[model samples]
Target chain A: MVGKHCILELYDCDHAKLNDEAFLRTTITTAAKRAGATLLNLITHRFEPQGVTGLALLAESHLSIHTWPENGYAAVDVFTCGDQTMPEQACELLRQELGAKNHALKSFQRETPAALATAVRHPKA
Target chain B: MVGKHCILELYDCDHAKLNDEAFLRTTITTAAKRAGATLLNLITHRFEPQGVTGLALLAESHLSIHTWPENGYAAVDVFTCGDQTMPEQACELLRQELGAKNHALKSFQRETPAALATAVRHPKA
Candidate 1:
């Protein structure tokens, strides 16, 4: 089955929130629920100085967040396979919850083999 | 910090191997090690009819696979931060281990805010 993947770059986020382990864990869980994804489990790691990385395993797929608190930045990935889920919704929730001033988002569809066969190819750069 | 992200699409993979949970778990762990990434933990789930989804939490970042055995296709994502780790190496190892006849890969850098500001922008489609 094909799926949708979103790569979100959040800029000028709240540094404190980004570094808070509990906050990130909650935010990701909430974001997954908001996106209509079934959260299987969440695993997080807090860096020594400052920073947090969190991943949520979903039945549909996964959602992850990696934060650079010093720069007020965070990178998020949301990929979900069934049509019932909306990955963009998860991105928006993260943007708002993380207090990002400006964000860049790239969304693309993962194609199945049959569709990929017919898809246009770009020569390796 | 900027990180490299690779989106890999495998076609004509070995169906039995794709559906095997144990094989995927070992393959992904070995692939991560080959890329010089430290493994944190791995979580996997197998679908009812025939399919498998596995995610490996790495100290550098994460690696994930979602397979559709009946279609002989598997989708993989590998994202890692820091210059020490090579995400592409992980992708190549997976391509070989999965026995994919043909594969498509897209690689991009997730830039920090400063670099993102000056980078070319593509208007929404």
Candidate 2:
């Protein structure tokens, strides 16, 4: 499995904007669509004080977000295993939608053990 | 917000073990509790061919996993923001529960913009 996993820390977003439930939901769903992820289910939870967590379960993989409005910060994680998913493009879309001033991203390539072992077996080939 | 995000790629797990819905659900839920995360909601989806996707939404943060049993592989994402949460401990728990032969972990620190910006402002204090 080729899982292009992307984790993003979005900073300095508008506090009010970060707290909007609808915006968070739609933005993640749209990102899933942009990434070519087939939506299986979507859930969004709003905290008592002021924060939101949204998760989109997809056939290809999943995308999730957690926001802290008080600090105007949001954390995002998008992992897709299929070949077609565009998680990076989705990140750009989210940065714009959240009005984040700056952000950091760390991505990982997740492969199956068999594949990794196979690579180790044929280091030169 | 200090978000300690851990993403794991578990390889060569027992396929039949991965297909057990209850185990998948409990593994994640327990991991949350171990991390001192308050459970908000939990959901698990089983794919047709042979896989499972579980998401545990916690007040402190969230934990999720997607399994590819055919490859003896699983992908895990655990993000916790509170200072009390012990994400690494949870990882060790999962590793034992899944009986993963090998695994890879990549972590990121998610900070609120104010905190990150403040650091940039004061370079050294």
Candidate 3:
């Protein structure tokens, strides 16, 4: 019933690596493995002149990154269910791998199954 | 620079429908289109016991949802860059499609390209 989700704003990332689609594709896969999540598939797309977006579909949940190389910023999300998935560790690893100097993180504890189920069954009128 | 991202916590979702994979896939794809995003691919997976995870790889950025049908809750992320992509509209469409009775949303203005570039070049020592 206890789980966590981290929404990350990574700034001052290495402009070069952020612009490299291959690097982002590989980095996210490694990040997911680092978090101990089973990787399902990694999808990546490189924008016209710059920027890259990568999404890692994982067995536990999902981790995604969208980078604006020209801006040296990347937005990352690591959402996992259960206690086994360590999203914070994955976020830290990515900050280091991407050479980001500053970041803002928002973390939340997902609602327990029992609590959510009850709300659905007994909706507020 | 002025773009937005919506981090949504959807509660009181339809438990039965949340477990269905096809419905989620199609819903997300349509959600992206509703946001004026060009779809790249939509990937979905059904868990062993229950729940579903769907990721929409959009040309603008990405949209993803992780459902805990057992919990009657779902986590949705709508991240899109530039003025052309309307993440709020997409989030609203999803709230309706999922039949969520209540939801919490967190929105933010992504750092501008010029601002992020400045931070990278002038890193704090």
Strongest candidate by DockQ? 2
Please say which candidate is ahead in TM-score: 1 or 2.
Answer: 1
Where model 3 places Cα greater than 4 Å from the true spot, the runs are A112-125, B112-125
- Every candidate's chain B TM-score: 0.88, 0.87, 0.87
Clashes of each: 0, 0, 0
Sort the candidates on DockQ, descending order.
2, 3, 1
Say which docking band candidate 3 falls in.
acceptable
Please provide, for model 1 over B1-125, each residue's C-alpha lDDT reduced to its tens digit, 9 standing for 90 to 100: 35889999999999999989999999999999988998887888887677788888887778999887878889999998777789889989989988999999999988666643322211112
Candidate 1 scores an iRMS of 12.5
Report the C-alpha lDDT of model 2 over B3-118, residue by residue, as the tens digit.
67887878878878888889888888888888887778888788765678888887777888887677777888888775778887778788778899899887767654545332
Indicate the DockQ of the complex predicted as candidate 2.
0.25
- How far residue B70's Cα lies from its native spot in candidate 2, in Å, is 1.7
* Sliding window of 10 residues with minimal summed lDDT for model 2 chain B: B116-125
Q: Which of the CAPRI classes, incorrect, acceptable, medium or high, describes model 2?
A: acceptable
Predicted complex 1: CAPRI docking category = incorrect
Q: What does candidate 3's lDDT look like per residue over A14-118, in tens digits?
A: 999998888887889889988888888788877766777788888777898988788778888888766667898889988999999899888887554555333
Backbone clashes (count) for model 2: 0
Tens digits of per-residue lDDT for model 1, A63-83: 999887878889899998767
> Candidate 3 — which pairs collide?
none
